[model samples]
Target: MTDTLIKVDLSQSAYDNDMIHNRWHPDIPMVAWVRPGDDFIVECVDWTGGQIKNDDDASDVRDVDLSQVHFLSGPIGVKGAEPGDLLVVDFLDIGAFSDSLWGFNGFFSKKNGGGFLTEHFPEAQKSIWDIKGMFTSSRHIPGVNFAGLIHPGLIGCLPSKEMLNTWNTREAELYNTDPDRVPALATLPYGPTAHMGRMQGDAAKSAAAEGARTVPPREHGGNCDIKDLSRGAKVFFPVYVDGGGLSMGDLHFSQGDGEITFCGAIEMAGWIHLKVSLIKGGMAKYGVKNPIFKPSPITPTYNDYLIFEGISVDEGGKQHYLDVHIAYRQACLNAIEYLKKFGYSGAQAYAILGTAPVQGHISGVVDIPNACATLWLPTEIFEFSIQPGADGPTIFDTKGIDVPLAKDL
Candidate 1:
């Protein structure tokens, strides 16, 4: 048996675990040490750190704290890793603990953590997916089942104080531009909710006050949320400090290209089988400042897809110039509208797009006036035929089955 280097007690609060931390600060002590070529197992609580529940009623989702998230499993130090080297990681395998065979996906209320399509669907809602080996399905969403592409949604190394200052300064600049916007432009460091692993006293307090929130993907790759970076993938992460303090959590059983739902993906408590190595001076060798990766060779092939297109026009019929965000949002909205004709409520259709292996593409950007984006919905994931036919469409008989919702307070 491979040694379980850092084991988490999921039954306890993630904050109570010394092995877990929510903020990124170089001063936080490494919990474990390993050498290059070492392979081990590390367990993690779900991203919300056990706040979201297995039950229906998205009240938990609605009230969930956005700040206290992405509780990561390690600052596991690699013996020889240093700044400007690449800490190479191979995700040999990833699986849910037998005790946790389920996961939750939810849309956040716009007032809280708004999603990509927060305007169209602006309240907190949730769907629970039950995992059965390689496959998953939801009682909250009937007539849909698919194999998951499991992966860690967040992973990265500790930033040197200089790098950390750059992140805070740049993000704060964006936040100040529209500081009061709902969900804010960017999440800044907050001392109250930070979990600085083993750090204590004024040191922990100061670091927490400036530590970067694990919300957006940064230069050090904090939370990229890419679905393709799954089990079997090999990633080369840029080391920013000595020992290359690497930490990761936010395991997702399945998710689309963009986790369109804010409380997104089939979020679960899981473990990763990882092998770490070093690429000496590989940062400059590869011209890499951002993390680079080779995706998993093994993945589910949902070949047949019904593709939907959207331009940069907003829902209000206002035209935007080459905006990929607006274009993707329109594509998602179009898919939801089409699915509604097949008897799925908009929320169910939206949740399906979030948890399934859907694809979003930026097809055109140089075209004048509008950028074209496409949403590819896999037909195989659905039990019934979803293709357009002369018979128009078959209503899927959803039978009042819908994801749980908690109206925004």
Candidate 2:
């Protein structure tokens, strides 16, 4: 662990890098090996594998293929690791590469990958944020700057073949229910675009056709996107295969809870300094079904917030019974409307909720006909005072400051 165990060439396509892969399968070979107690570095490309750029154009965000996403670094094998063991990972530190101090935040198109609130925002859009040491800001969205809560948006161990099959079967069943639905119910394996690290020819082909898409968080913890799992946090991951083929990427400089925008967060190309250990038979002992973690010891503190509440009622006034999803969406929409009162555009306000250290909570679910949800917008993130007053809201001169957009073709 004296040097970087895995390094990525940012200029190279992730599909061309033997150390990177987009699918998860036990057969995908580990690019490196490490024993318990080892500490090392692993570099990663942005989630879209550099598909999005620093420029203002959102066409790349609009045209990017969702199938070739989330290019991750490593299934780094750990010696003596076995199934049912817990792979204890300590995130010692994380940082954006000095050479690439910028990242992206965007909303995918409804026809492409519609997000949590896609119906309200049906088109593709993007905003680029420049990282300055521990803080980040975007020229596209004016009047705000804050410290980042950096973390890896996706990280986990490879699943056993049985678990992989279970994922495909269940997801396929759901997908089959609405095969032609926009944004898809589930992402199935696509062999042609799959990157089975270090595998070639027939073996690669066989694994690719069955490999699980790294789109959702499964039992082994792929793409959970928890903003609290940042540097200084520790995770206990369930190992389903020997060597605990651990892989991680999709780094973010900052992300609000829910990552409402599917192409959400201040996505970045960065490095993680981690230390690993094992707790043999700990999974069963702890009755763990999925990954668990301790919050980062060092994280951004934004206590002052403006909280917005929403019920299970839809935007069109259609009432639904105990639907947290719809409630949360309403809460997010409520916050965006509040931001607009201060002169921020709808898109810019939406982007802020996606990238800033905002908080969302399922406030109440047993309230009879309606579920209650709350969205907490950190007042401290804004330069101007956002607290409500007797004089109503103070509108800022936002004129031209706005998030970039790319209309669907």
> Candidate 2 lDDT, tens digit per residue, 252-351?
9999999999888999999999999999998999999999999897768888889999999999999999999999999999999988999999999999
State residue 6's C-alpha deviation in candidate 2, in Å.
0.7
How accurate locally, in lDDT, is each candidate?
Answer: 0.93, 0.93
Cα lDDT, model 1, residue 124: 92
- Estimated TM-score per prediction? 0.99, 0.99
Given candidate 2, what's the lDDT at residue 16?
87
* Pairs with backbone N, CA or C atoms under 3 Å apart (clashes), candidate 2: none
Model 2 TM-score, 2 decimals:
0.99
Cα lDDT over the full model 1? 0.93
